[model samples]
Target: KHILRYVRGTTNMGLFFKRDGTRRIVGYSDSSHNIDIDDGRSTSGHIFYLGSSPITWASQKQPTVALSSCEAEFMAATEAAKQAIWLKELLKEIQSIEEKVILRIDNKSAIALTKNPVFHGRSKHILKKYHFIRECVENEQIEVEHVPGKEQKADILTKPLARIKFKK
Candidate 1:
């Protein structure tokens, strides 16, 4: 009954994707800084969309604990990039997409990491699985850019915020 009640409340919660919508697929990504009290691992959150409607969204704890806030955000961005590429391929199968996916991340350091070739000592310990995003960047399949934290929509999934912040 609780599940049914929640479902009823979510009657307006739906995503609309149109065939004629713009081929531009964009993504928003965010992360919490050491929110896990037990292991101190950060949580990564991402949402991808076809035009304005979201096609995919996820929020999960990072397997390894991050050393810094930037590292946590960087890992979250990497996860988003991975999903963007997958969605691109899926969309290509249904229809041709002209515009490359643009990923918006709130952390500037994470954006810089995507462009930087040399990995610093602190970042070196990150799992190799996340480097797939680097390959996507080099191939120009996805581009990560800086976005101000105040406007990061994915923040809602990653961490709690004030009602005013969430409303914006």
Candidate 2:
């Protein structure tokens, strides 16, 4: 009963999309380190935008526990890359020529890890699947850049934000 009420109340809400003159999809990823006390797993979040409006987004608990904050962010980024590739392909249906997808992550270390293979020793313990982002970066299918935590829209999804931040 409550669910239906919430849905009905929000039915009038809609997304506003404007042409930003940029034919590209951009994404932001964030993760909260070990927020799930029971499993010691982090929550991963990502949001993709077409122009200034969000096209797709996700927030979920990581499948595995990440030993460090960097690892948690790294894993979160890998998931975001997967979503970016999928969204990029979907964009091809309407636009034949699309620019490379860019993903913004707040963690500089994870961004660097995605670009260089020299961190092999540090990353070897991570699940092999999480390494998919490295290939995506090397192939130039997606580009990862650093975005400060305050500007990360996905911050709301990874963890609970203070009332002030939430209002932003």
Error of 1 at 160 (Å): 1.8
lDDT of 1 at 43: 96
Q: How many clashes show up per model? A: 0, 0
In the range 1-168, model 2's lDDT, one tens digit per residue, is 999996897787677888888777889999999998898999999999987879999999999999989999999999999999989988898787468899999999899889986657778899889989999999999989999988999999998889788666
Cα lDDT for residue 148, candidate 1: 92
Q: What tens-digit string does per-residue lDDT give for candidate 1 at 6-116?
A: 689778756567665577888999999999898899999998877767788999999888888888888888888878888888888998985778999988888877777
Off by over 4 Å in 2: 1-14
The number of residue pairs in model 1 that clash at the backbone is 0
Report lDDT per candidate. 0.84, 0.91
Best by lDDT: 2
Report clash pairs, candidate 2. Answer: none
